[model samples]
Target: MADDPFQSRFAADASLLPHMADLANDRVLVALLAEADYRAASFLDQRLLTDRVGREWMAWDALPDLGAAAAGPHFIFHIGHVGSTLVSRLLAEVGDVLPLREPMLLRTLAQVAERIERPESVWSPELYRTRLAQTLGWLGRGFAPGQRAMVKASSVITAVADDLTGSDGRALFLHVPLPRYLETILAGEASMAETLAQAPARMARLAALLPDFPHALWQLPPVTRVAMSWLCEMATAQRRLPPDDPRRLWVDFEAMLADPAAALMAQATHFGLPIDPARIEAALAGPIMRQYSKAPEHGYTPDLRRELQAQAAADHAPAIAEAIAWVEALAARYTNLADLPILGDQSVIQEVRCSS
Candidate 1:
């Protein structure tokens, strides 16, 4: 055996990926990407990468087959509610851009495809990995071979990024929750309360199932789910307070109202996103902002009222009281963008994010 030539080639950079991938383990991928510096600052497109590899590299596992594609690079991604809609809409304004929404279905598919055990929940793991690749494939298929796709993802399936296939596609991931958003989170406890009322009660249950996944790639999702659990718990406590008692929440709605764009912009920038500061300011000036306005019949729920009354004592009560006051104080700050089209453009689904 002259030093096992086949084994050596198997782990070689090219085969290393598919081989390690076949092992049903995502560790190699994680280590490689973290080392690659996804957070590095850059304004240039990856035109040179095409020269190095001869052809473009779309994502490995997630993309659709679009048959024929247009020219230029693409931006794809996953994002939460934190100013992402604004960023995506703005990015769409950029020429030659084909943006994808949450990409939730693909996310579920990836989880199912390479996951250790199939998930029996909302997502279909069996179809996860390839579907995302298929999406990239389809998106890329519509473009030239060397075109790049800047994709923003909803449920971040970074492990599946390399697996995505199509034209030459490289991804830049941005974590949109920034300092201002965190401050708002810390300050606006009532908002948290409101979030709880609206969020699914099953969220807490989902956080506990992380250990069941096959690969470390699956761990990231639960980190988010776990955080949700804490917020939901805190919210449950906040809902128990009386209207007058303060300390139920964290931040102020009045201040948030005065500078909606400013507050939102801080969140956008915090995630290393590229957003126009001027537009952020413009967004605030338009009427219809804040969590929700107070209407006599269309106000707080019974679950909330009881939660507040029950929490009037002990440690949780004060936090909730403060939050309620914070929400009440800013009642005038909200404009309910639900009616206003995105960026003031009411067209196909591309420009609209109207409220329910």
Candidate 2:
């Protein structure tokens, strides 16, 4: 290991992960990680930074330019609570993809990108662009020569989806129907808390798109706030990952649940990974599907999720209906949201139910 405090060893060794960026200080926090560490982590954020992991801070300028050899560090952008972590875990089981889930640095970059042009912005336009490029390059490195990096970004990171993935980049935009999204969020105390915590940021993003955005965060009920979170994320996805883009794939989480093998194959093909039916089947049948992905020790299954959603639907029927109506009203008002693909797609929902 090198003794220099300011030099980044990430280029020479992929184990040194760039955990987070300090934009104001012009340095990045790097953590030493191994293949097993990446596999074991549910998130690449502070939770994964334990006392056992070696850490250092490197000047941004000292970070090496490894862009030439970088391949896709592709993306999995989604609306929160939509089983993205599960998808990332299954993909990791497939053997050729390295999954980086919800890296804190991406969230930091997203925050900065939101105000890059404002007076309070921390980085100049030139520096921001340079750092963004460097970050992407750093993320693209994998342990093996042929393995590809797949980033599962946090939900809010979708606000910068366009920046993270340019014209030629590949990604999977995952989401669920409004009614179901509300049910899932409302069913859990922690989920509702997260929804409320993120409401202010979601509101600001929504306001940017819909200037006449009605209702302050406090004015709306909890269900309505959840709906606003969905709109902010889904609208950003629709704008950044257009329907016509060949490189981007739009997948409904319900549709994925309907046929795990098919969905996994489609995603694998999209990312140019080798597809083996046997391996896909094994991954599906393995413990990943049965256990709650974010916390593997807690047992959770598709059936359990359906039961929870059913209870939530029965318990919060009125609020769920109101939330759906609210979203429909916005769709009617905004031309951009009028044709949002999965809003009322009965066929997809029916397929999931039928398969189940």
Candidate 3:
């Protein structure tokens, strides 16, 4: 490495992780991150980039390209509040995995991807593709030779899942049934506020997919607004990683909670990671399971989550029923949404007791 902090050791070292891609400014913010730093931080966004972390911004073109030879940089794409962080934590604990949770750079790229074809787009198609490859190469670097870099993307990043993942790239699409998803989001004031705030953008994305998407964001109540969020994300996943795709694995978060060790083992195999049953067992029994994944100091467990969901469901039963009916109506009208494995499987929904 050179004396210059931003001297472009992106290809050679995993420490210089690209923290943010400022497309408007044509620069990338790179941060020096160690194994401990990656493990300690919940998200690799501006929140985690404290004054203590060494960082600098470099022009986009100045970044060295590692080309198409970068190693495994698989992904975990999930609907929000579905234990995606927990999955990332468990994988990180099992070894041979370099976990990068919600890196803001990817979010920037996803936003750029949404407008790449538009007349007013900042990046031309060629530059966007090149930068996407370069960013992935930078993210693919690992502390050890065989350690695979696994990114658990922010929920909305699913909008560009197809663009981010190559044909050979493997991804786990984590989600829960619609009713459970509503319960989880509606249970928290912050989560509900986020859902409402993001509803318009999500509705726009959903309209792009389903040309006849009928309801406006203003037309829907709070509960259905949350349902629309699920539909938009889950539909994006369905379109991007179809069931026939060999590189994609679909994992239900509820099923994972039921049998975590087995779920972890299966997920490891899906990503071609080396399996250590002992390590998986240790992770399940470890502190990560007991602590809130996004904030380790806060204690949160599956039992607590269930209690919250139950209370939310009971308190808002009428609104929830209306939201479910709204989704069911859409599913019936749209062939693409009709056969969604989560929506179609009554046994799965019934097992969760989402319908009483």
Candidate 4:
């Protein structure tokens, strides 16, 4: 029999090369990347991909209906700086799952969601829904048979969390409590600085959630501003999560670090991944856990992280203290957030509140 184009995974080009979709014009533009450089870059920087990789384009309207295609792809949704990428990388050790780390299409759809309510909007909710469904269908395509697709979405895309994990799909929401979030950001070389710099743009989109939000939030200290963004995203995810839904799960980054193997197995079971007990044991003993999940070249043991966080907390005590206070003050404004496992416990809250 002649070779089917789609069956030839390497030659299918669409399946082999990474692709980014743009919905700017009257039509959608699908740009296929031709190089393997910077596979670790954020989906938002996908345009820079053209500089390194060759490209090919396909108009969105010209494509056939993908709505009826696979719909149950898994997702790793998170607040920024949590260990989501680590979890995604670990999950890929399972033989049957193909993990996609922040696809550009998802970021595009998410950006679309942000502008959905604009006055001069050219896109309607229905159109957005259809496009997302089709785009996800294309992304869900497994590079090889029997391999399921899992996506680690960008934290900003949490704006579309519910839409992405609708009836067909399942997801895990990863986050840390307010104090740890501040600690992680502060410990990083430039993550906190970068987040602070982008506050105006990110806060503009979140203003509707809190009355007089953007202006009010901007008045706060730089540390407090970043903390507010974390709370906003967490609050959004909390509201969208349905009670007693087996398809959705909430995980604490701290807990995962304390006992990684248990966390991985539980997550695997939750996602219905049939990883063998032996394989799970082997993976835990492997080198993946020894290095930083995002920057595999660097070492990132739990002890090292603890030392760094402790040092960071001590060094940035004044700023971290102010940021924690800001978070507690805003907690009442989001009572729904108070019910979360991370935020609800007054003991945990008080502990962090009194820290430093």
In terms of lDDT, model 2 sits at 0.85
* Residues 279-309, model 4: lDDT tens digits: 7778778877787877788888666766677
- Model 3: residues with Cα > 4 Å off, grouped in runs: 1-8, 342-356
> What's the true lDDT of residue 45 in model 3?
91
lDDT of 1 at 40: 23
- How do the residues 5-74 of candidate 1 rate in per-residue lDDT, one tens digit apiece? 6333322222111101222422112112110222121111232123222332223332122223432224
C-alpha TM-score for every candidate: 0.33, 0.95, 0.95, 0.84
Model 2 Cα shift for residue 58 (angstroms): 1.8
**What residue pairs clash in candidate 2, if any at all?**
none
Q: For residues 62-181, what per-residue lDDT tens digits would candidate 2 score against the true structure? A: 777666445548999999999999999988887598889998999889888888999999888887787788788888888888888899999989888888987678999999988878
Off by over 4 Å in 2: 1-9, 354-356
State residue 343's C-alpha deviation in candidate 4, in Å: 5.6
TM-score for predicted model 2 compared with the true structure:
0.95
State the RMSD for candidate 3.
Answer: 2.5
lDDT of 3 at 90: 93
